[model samples]
Target: MALPDRYTGDDFYCDVAIPSAAQLDVVHDDELVLAYHHTRPFWATHLVVVPKRHIDSFTSVTECDEADVRQLFAVVQRLAREVTEREGAAAVLTNLGRYQDSKHLHVHVHSGPQRDHT
Candidate 1:
């Protein structure tokens, strides 16, 4: 039989750091939280926001998880504002299936210089 949609696996959670690997100041955190920017980023400013909980994916969100979801979005909005203030603009995104790398549910917040088509 196929594995259940919400199977708790080893790759569920992760430790997110800012500057990709370089130790920097922590902007925000909670009991289970990791938020930071990428050292080598696609955008001028790229940050990864994830819950300490090992959630499978967005599709796995349950009715009981409504509060968690709300909290996640709230954080995202707050972070977006911060990024906009710092970078002048921001974008939020999440991946699914093959696009997902950590296996844990996460949202990517990006902002910075706009790419120029040469």
Candidate 2:
């Protein structure tokens, strides 16, 4: 199902713009709007990227937001490249519906050791 035109505004739950002090240095001040690293990373590196604006979800995104989405992905790609150079691989992802926690649209970038094949 699709979301409503007007965001519920409750989507803005996070106030800790940047998760850590080190993150401040790692992420570009101007480029970074908000971020958070996974406590238990599925990969070696897992970080969340969010725009300052409160966007509901990917499906809620409109044609007017194309540039914003492009810019957001550019940042994600840059981070992925950095991780790849440091760890040999990176993965980007996003969730919807029940999978999402805050209801705000965000992307996740993960990198690290490969899972062993049983």
Candidate number achieving the greatest lDDT relative to the actual structure:
1
Taking the tens digit of each residue's C-alpha lDDT, what string does model 1 give over 1-118?
Answer: 2223353443533443422223633445665556666434567777776665666778888887676677777788899999889778889999998887667777878986744435
Error of 2 at 111 (Å): 1.4
Superposed model 1: Cα runs more than 4 Å off: 1-12, 15-25, 113-118
Q: In each prediction, how many residue pairs overlap at the backbone (N, C-alpha, C within less than 3 A)?
A: 0, 0
> How many clashing pairs does model 1 include?
0
lDDT of each: 0.66, 0.64
Candidate 2, which segments miss by more than 4 Å at Cα? 1-26, 31-42, 113-118
Model 1 TM-score, 2 decimals:
0.69
RMSD of each: 8.4, 8.4
Candidate 2 per-residue C-alpha lDDT over 8-96 given as tens digits, one digit per residue, 9 for 90 to 100: 44453233333333433235334434555643356657877776566788879988777667777778888888878988878888989
